[model samples]
Structure formats: structure tokens, C-alpha cells
Target: MSKSYDAARDVFAGWEVDTEAALTALSQIPISMHCWQGDDVVGFEKKTGSSGGGIQATGNHPGRARTPEELRADLEFAYSKIPGKHRLNLHAFYMDTDESPDRDEIEYRHFIPWVDWAKEQGLGLDFNPTFFAHAKADDNLTLSHPDAGIRDFWIEHGKRSREIAARMGEALGSAAVNNIWVPDGYKDIPVDRMAARQRLEASLDTMCAEKHDKAHMLDAVESKLFGIGVEACTVGSHEFYLGYAIKRGTLLCLDMGHFHPTENIADKLSSVALSVDELLLHVSRPMRWDSDHVILQDDSILQMAQELVFTGLLDRTHIGLDFFDATISRTAAWVIGSRNMQKALLRALLLPQDRLKEVEENLDWTTRLMLTEEARDLPFAAVWEEFCERNEVPAGLGLIDDLDAYQASVAGRG
Candidate 1:
């Protein structure tokens, strides 16, 4: 379609720190595809390499284990299927195994393939806090573990991950990892509660250490909840938890869908960036009361824009597309996710940033969008009307990938 409000004007009005360069940088970001692997990773029957892990899916508890051939086959297939534009990485160290999990080839397992892929694709692999460390027979993996009094669990385990990461870096050509998603927190069955908190912090403290050898790209620290929470996560809405981690030099990974729908996410995010503890970022449109990790732009576009802009550190955000489905084929799942998130990013690019700033800072953002505004000056529909009228989308038949813009820019040899 024809252009609407100019992005340049909006950047100018907002007083962005490096307005020119930041706007220039926008064209380079691609929506990333993340997949969780292991026995559960390649569940499709049509696939040549996938194994069912001989674990029955029908049970109160889940089970998953991967045979070596099964694991190699899936990784190989993923490598071959990856397109030129989209980068690929291991989703999260392929955890979720039962206790007494096998650690054969422990040091070389995930890294060897990652190294091969990096050599092939010239890209990096994403990893997480739990990827390297084992909780051990003595240490508590869950916050609900009996030895809640232990403060050294993470201190010990994280150190191990660090050692493993150093080896992995040899394979990565000295690149900081593609991403790090930390799933550390509580589950609320509260027995030794304070002890549980200490253990959880211990886990995080290990991930927070500064490694000068490789620029540790801390993707995001996620704080989430359980259905009823037996080892209830202590990191929930507690300002001190993230603050403490930052003081030690780590970063918060914001899962966009984790917060309750009514929470003030954007403002809190501003604090997160202003605070010194963030690594990478995760963004998914949260379906109501559900962390489905669905496509973005499901929320009011204006608010999403506000949140994206408020961070002021979009340059640092890794922007992982965290979509999941238990049934679809992996390739199809990846493609569906690829389209869904690009649409959101495209929409953000289309939004008029200056107007979004006015609405975010001054108005009752949700209420104004939801049409609950009774105040005549801040009319409910007017802002949206102006917004829609002012915004512009690329006039096209299909979604555009982030790389398209870069390639087009390169074609002219500029």
C-alpha cells in the first residue's frame, strides 16, 4: 500500500538516543524460529529418523528419551530443512528427561552438531541455563526439593555449564551463543519455602556470571507460574529477584505471555532495560490466560508497539519466536510460526511511533483501546482512528521476511 505516517518523524519526536542508526538497524532483524528437541522433538510418523521414545503419551506423567540415531537423524533433518534466510539453533538444550537421565557423550553431545551446523549455515546455536548443569543426586533441581536450605546448588551447577559453554564456544568460532532462555523459578507446594527461594537464586546466579572469553548473550530470564504450583516460583512479580540478579550482572528474559493480562508489562520492561540485567528476549502473543506462545499482533497493535518501543533497547532484543504445537509436523510448525511472527514485526514497522508514544504515556492504554474511555478529550475511538488512518502496511500478496529488505538493500550495492 501507499505510505502513511513517516517512521523518521516518529523517531525524531521520541528523542531516541541514536535515532538515525536505530531506525537503520530495524531492517536487519529477522523473526527467529525456535524448536525444542529430544525424543519428544521429532514426533512425526512420516519422518524417517523420528522415534516415539517407547514412552506412552497417555499418562498423568510424561516420558521422553532419545536413542543416538534418533537424535542425530532429527538434527540432520533440521539442518537440511533450514532455509537461507532463517537461522536455526537448539531450542533449549533438549531437556525434559526423567530422573537418572543418561549423560553419555555428555560434553560433546549438543556441541558437535551445533558446530557442524554453524560451519554449514555460518550461524550460532541457542542454549539455556539448565543446558549444561545437572542438579546431581544431592542438589535439588526443583524448588520443592527437601534441601531448600542449600544456597550453593546453582553456584555449583552453573559453574559446570560455564565450563561446558567454553568448550561449545570452540565449536561456535568464538561467537556468544545465539540465545539463552532461563526457565528458573518455583512451583508452590511450599514446605521449606525460603530454602526453595535460595536454591532458585543459586541456579540463576550461575547464569549471571560475566564471561569475557565469549560475549555471553543472555537471551531472557523467564519467570512463570504452575497450575497450582507445588514448588511455587519465588520470582513471580517480586522486584527484588531480578534486581538482585542484575546487581550481579545478568539480564531478564521477558516472556511476553507470562504476565497476567491486566499487568502493566511495558512500564515494567522499561525498568528492566534501565536496570543492567538483560541478555536476550522472547516475544509471543499471549492468548488470554494462556501462555500458548502464539503469533504476535493478537493484542491491540498500538499497545504492542508501545511495549516494543518502550524497551528502547530493541537493538539488544533477540526476538525469539516461541511457537509450539503438540501435533503438527516440525517443518509445518516452523513455517506456521515463521509467518505468524513476521506479520507482527511487519505490523510494528507499519505503526507510527510518535503517536504511539503519546497514547502510551498519557492515556489509559488498555481502556482507551478497549473503548472504556468516558473522558471526551481522550476519546476511545479517536486515537485508534487516527492510528489506523496514519499507519501503512507493505502492499503485497504474501508476508515479507526480514532478509528480503536486507537483500534488496544489498542488490544496489549501497
Candidate 2:
């Protein structure tokens, strides 16, 4: 260990916080890095379409991956810079195959390449059913569409996605979280909201009728507020999914940017943990809107990590990043976001939670507040640097030059 790390360790020891233990715990936790960032949500589909579901990757950044091979290479580079083992969160549309199959006709064979790649990289995989960027979703209504044919089409796609996810999980020996998020809502005030929700519920029932083993796959539902087109109402609101998750025994996905601007998802963690068996967090930074900016070590992320640690819900919560900033080096974006999340978790792990809870239980508000504020000034940087060294990744700005060299190499993609 470095001299700085040894000094920091002594400081933490005074507070009854074991620095070694914190680093070990942080290493065990894996952040599911989103693959959409590599290609700006433009999957390797032969018949490409618009990304119209309130999901837009702004900026014509150079060197965006044009093929699955390129994306995988970029992801490989990203994983190298980031500390600890991680998982890849893939969307259904990111299939790598020569066969042209519509969304509903997709099968596990189409994504065999991804599974093989993940095996080689020693990474787990997660999945999502893409419900946007197609002709059927042009109206921003999918499973809840008034037209029966359109709804059935989306329902079949969802079913196929689940099957694909199960295969991936079984192949990798980990439970792949198949999260479902749809852009089904209205732009203007609706005449009757009840019918749409009822239809959505019925469609979901049919889509999830075939149960897969929990060890191979887990179902999760993600809810969003109003989007670009659906400014009036989002069909799968948080309330709807929370209730559905509780009743159906599925994981509830809480996306940081999917809620109101003033709403803090950190506060909802403990409350929802009581009802849902597991949770899937889409950690993101929303700039004014659901801009999906790269996350930082901000208060929002810190409090979220603190909640998960304090409530003892870390085991049940799957951490996944959700952002696509095409404005910067895509690989650097992945590295920065993943490292920030790890830093937040490491900070949380080093907290004197037992003492804080003890003071709070005794109604000593002053000490509780003081200790919490004082904990912020701990020598977290030294400890973090040590962690990076141990993980064989660059610490601090050491990665900037490497990322710049990588950008130069890939600039020819234009």
C-alpha cells in the first residue's frame, strides 16, 4: 500500500471503519455498464429506424461504433479502464447476426455472438426489450395501443426478449435481469386513461405468461414520466409499476432520470424494498430533462449508495448505469460513469453507519448531523487511489491520455 493509503487507513480506523473491508466489498459489487453508449443507442440492425422514444443521443461525435464487432471492442477497452468486474446491459435490438428478423421474430440464436463475447470477457449480461424506434411505436403507444394488431406485435417482441435474456443468463451462469420499459403514453390530455392501462396490464400478462427459472432470468419493469412526445401522460408510471411489481413478484426498476425533477429516488429505496423482492437501479444524471448525461460523484448518487448500504439492501439491488453522451469519447464516458458509481459505493461502505444509527436511535440529532457532515471530509481519495492500483486501472486523470490516444485511433470510423 502507498504511504498516503496507509495514513488514510489509520484515519478510518479511528472511526471504526475498516478500509480494507470497504475496498473488498466494493470490488464484489459489479456495475452493469450500458452498451447503448458505445453506438449511441443505434443497434446493429440491418433495417435501422429512428430513435424516437424520447431517447435521443445528441451530438455527431466521431468514431461511434458502426458494427457489433466495433461496439464490443469499444466495450472491451472501457472495461479495462474501469475497476472491478462488471456486467453488460444490452437492448433487444442489439442483435448480432446475418439473418434479418423483425422484433417479434427474434430468437436466442441471433444474440449468440454477444453471449460468446461475454463468456470470453468473463462478464455477466442483462437485457431490455426495445419498445421504441420503429414504425409501430411512431405514435408513442406500444403495448397499450388501441389497435389490437400493434399491441400483439409489441407483446410478442417482449416475450421473445425474455427468452433471449434467459438463454444469456443460463449460458453465463448468472441471472440476467430482463427489464421492460415501454414508451406508451399520450401527448395531449386523454379522454380515458383506464382503458390504456388495462390493455397494457393484459398485454404484460400474456407476454410474461411463460415463467423462466429465477436462477437463469429475472423480470423487471421500468417506469418513466413524460417524455418528448408523451408530454401529457406516461402509461407505465411509477405507481403503476410499483403496484405491479408488488403483486406479480418482479423487480422494480427505479431510473434516476425517469421521475420528476424534484423527486429524489434515493428516498424511495427503503420504502420500495419492503414490497419488492429485488430492485434494478438505472443510475443517471438528468440535465434539466431526461438528457441521460454521464453520472458524477454528486450528492444524488452518494445518498443513493448510502441508502442501499444503510438499509442492508445492497444484496438485492442490481446497479446499472443508463446514459448515452455522444458528445464525448464514448469509451471515456463509460469509464468515468462506472468509476464514479464505484467511488460513491466505496464512500458509502466506509461510513460509520453503526455509530450514526446509534446516535439517531438515542435521538441525538446534533451528533448525528455533525458526524454525517464530518464523514464527508474523510481521506476517500487516497483509499480510492489504492483501489484503482489494486484493480490495475489508472487512478484520477491518468486515463485521459490513454482515452485521447484511443480516440485518435478510432477517428477513421468517420
Candidate 3:
């Protein structure tokens, strides 16, 4: 919690920014550092310890310091540059194509080891996600189809994941594993919804029965879609699915970016408020095209008010910042992350919950509230200014100085 969010939270709660816990909670936001790859995260790192450096020459050299020893030091330095307890998200897609007999075998073999490694680094890694392959291939389960092979493939993944988690639990003496993410659903029809439902239902049942050999729960189904290949997944559809999942013992993983164009902000927020179990999630920039997952505190923050409003109403869901930014180097990514979610933290703590329900129930009030912000209107550089101005640059914040310090930075250099 920094100064800006600290003030925002108290005001939202009808209290002044005075209490220590409230201030600490408000000021500290969860930033998901791009721990996917140490060097090539979005192709930002160049050689070791080097960065994109904005304009490629001058600017905040957007690179981390050298070695694992230097990572935290860099992170600490990054904190002086940013702020808060970051809920960093990392990925272990694969080490190399040559690391195993083949892609699938290797992914399964390396899964738990990578998770253990993340824990050692005090981080969490999203499991090998589905709905990405778009299986037009040998029984690939990435796409939607009226095919049994695809569902079978998915079952394999679930089964292997369960088994691996079991082994890891025994070997590690105990551990916590999570299955997280949403996928691009069926594209070309024949997606027997009931079958897909049955498969996942059975799979979840088995996993729960076995306990996955460790403490486990799903974050969210992570509903998203591309309009052309697949019509955008309507927020209402996701809302229905998420509620169903909560009943199944798995929780929702709300990606605020996944809402449809027609989705009411309050409806989306209300969905979260309605869920009962832990609603784990990954936060990133709001996308106009797809899951670009830019930084949340940047242009996409227009979606914040409703998002925070919902989180404020509940205590079950746990939030994490998950980002994907291609424009900057990994270090800059980390700094941007820190600066972005810190505000979300404070904002959540300060939510006008009592008014939230009132606003949610009365769509007009919520609309008026969202429309009041410049970000909600222009949704670009224009509102980013409002974001900074409203958040009020705290002492030693990196992102705040972007304009003046970055004028000659990433400008015109792309």
C-alpha cells in the first residue's frame, strides 16, 4: 500500500487514511513479475543483466541485475522504483524441445520440478495450460469439436497432472499445487457441451477424490475468445460457468480482461461477489483485441472501479497480478507490475462496499460511476495521466516519472 491507494482506500471506506494495518493493506498491491523466463520474457532481456532501456540507448535501462543473487537485489531496487508484495506469476512451458523424449513427455516430467523450483524462489507457476493448442492435429484438445479424441487428450492432461502432483507431494513431504487458466473454447462447432462438461466434471471428481495428493484448487476457468476464429466469450456465459465451478469445489479465476463488450461492469463485479470459494486470479492489462495482458495500471485500468468493487465485497477470493507486456524489457515489466497492482491493493481495501451493492443493483449508478473517469472514456494515454494524477505519485515511484524521464526514452524508437 503506497500513499495514493492508502488515501483512496480510507476514503472509499468512509474513513480517513490513519490506521497502520489499513495503510499497509492499501499501499501494498500484488504485482506479478514476469517470472516466466529469466532472460527472454517477451524477448526483453538481452544477454545477461541487460535490458531494452526504453529508446535502446537512454531511459530507465529496462533490465535486471546479474545472476540469481542479483534478482532480489534488482527486485529490491525495483521496489524502490515501484512498491508492495508482488504476487508474481511464472510459467514453465518447457525448458527445451530436447529436454525429453518428446514435448508431452517432457512437459509432464518437468512439471513438478519447476513448481518446486518456483516455491524455492518464493513464486507460483501456472500449470501447463489448455485451450491453447487448438487441436486440429492428432487428438489435440485445444480446439472445440464433436470428437472424443480431444476430450481424451484433456483427460490425459488432467490425469498426468494429478499423478505428478501426487508424486511431488510424497517426495517433497508436502506441497501445494494449483490448476489454473482458461482456454479458447471450441471453434468449428460439434463441441458437445455436455460431453466437455462431463469430462471435466469426472476429472475434477477424480482429482478431488485423490486429493491430487496435495492441497489443491482451481483458480478460474479463464474464459476468453477471439471474435473471428471464435466469437468473443460473452461475460454472461463465463458467469454461468464460474458459478457452476464453485459448486464443483473449484473456484473462479476472474480475468477482468475477459469481459465482453456488452458486459455490464456491475454484472461482472456481481459475479465475483456471488462466488463462495476462493476466487484466485491473474490480473493484467485490459485488451481490446485479445489477451495482450499488458500492465494493469496502464491504459487498461478503465475497468478497475468495478473490479475492485467486487473484490472489496468478498473475503474468499485471493488476487494475484498476472501480466504480459511486449513493449518493454523484463525489468521494466517487473517495475510496471509493481507500480500497477499496488494501487489495486489500496483500492480494494478502500472499496465502497455498501454502496457497491447499491450501485451494482442499480445499473445506472454504476454506469455513472464508471463513466466519471477519463480512463473509462478515452482509455488511452489521456486516461493514463488521470491514473497517475489520481493515484498521486508516492515517493520513489518509477512509473510516475515515465513521462518526463521517458520522453527521450522509448519514444519513436519502437
Model 2: per-residue Cα lDDT at residue 96: 96
Best by TM-score: 2
- For each of the candidates, give the backbone clash count: 24, 0, 10
Each candidate structure's TM-score, on Cα atoms with residue i matched to residue i, is 0.60, 0.99, 0.61
Query: Which ten-residue region of model 2 has the weakest summed lDDT?
Result: 45-54
State the lDDT of candidate 2 residue by residue for 311-339, as single tens digits.
99999999999999999989889999999
For model 3, name the residue pairs that clash.
Answer: 1-26, 1-27, 1-28, 2-27, 9-350, 29-342, 144-186, 219-253, 220-253, 279-317
lDDT of 1 by residue, 1-414 (tens): 112234433533343323334333444554455644223333211222222221111211122223434443434443333222344444323532222323222243444555565567555555543422333322223322345333344344444445455555566554344333233343444455566556555555544454535453332445544322213543333354466547665456555555676765555666666766444545555665334444544553335444565445556555565544434333334444554444444344444445445666787587445432222222222222233233322212222342243224323321
**Mind giving the per-residue lDDT tens digits that candidate 3 earns over 52-108?**
211011123344333333344344344445543333343323332224222223244
Better of 1 and 2 by lDDT: 2
**Residue 5's lDDT in candidate 1:** 30
lDDT of 1 at 132: 22
TM-score of 3: 0.61
Question: Candidate 3 overall Cα lDDT vs. reference?
Answer: 0.43
Supply candidate 1's per-residue lDDT for 407: 26
| Runs in model 3 lying further than 4 Å from the true structure | 1-15, 26-82, 95-98, 101-120, 124-140, 143-150, 162-177, 180-209, 213-219, 225-228, 232-240, 262-266, 289-293, 296-314, 348-414
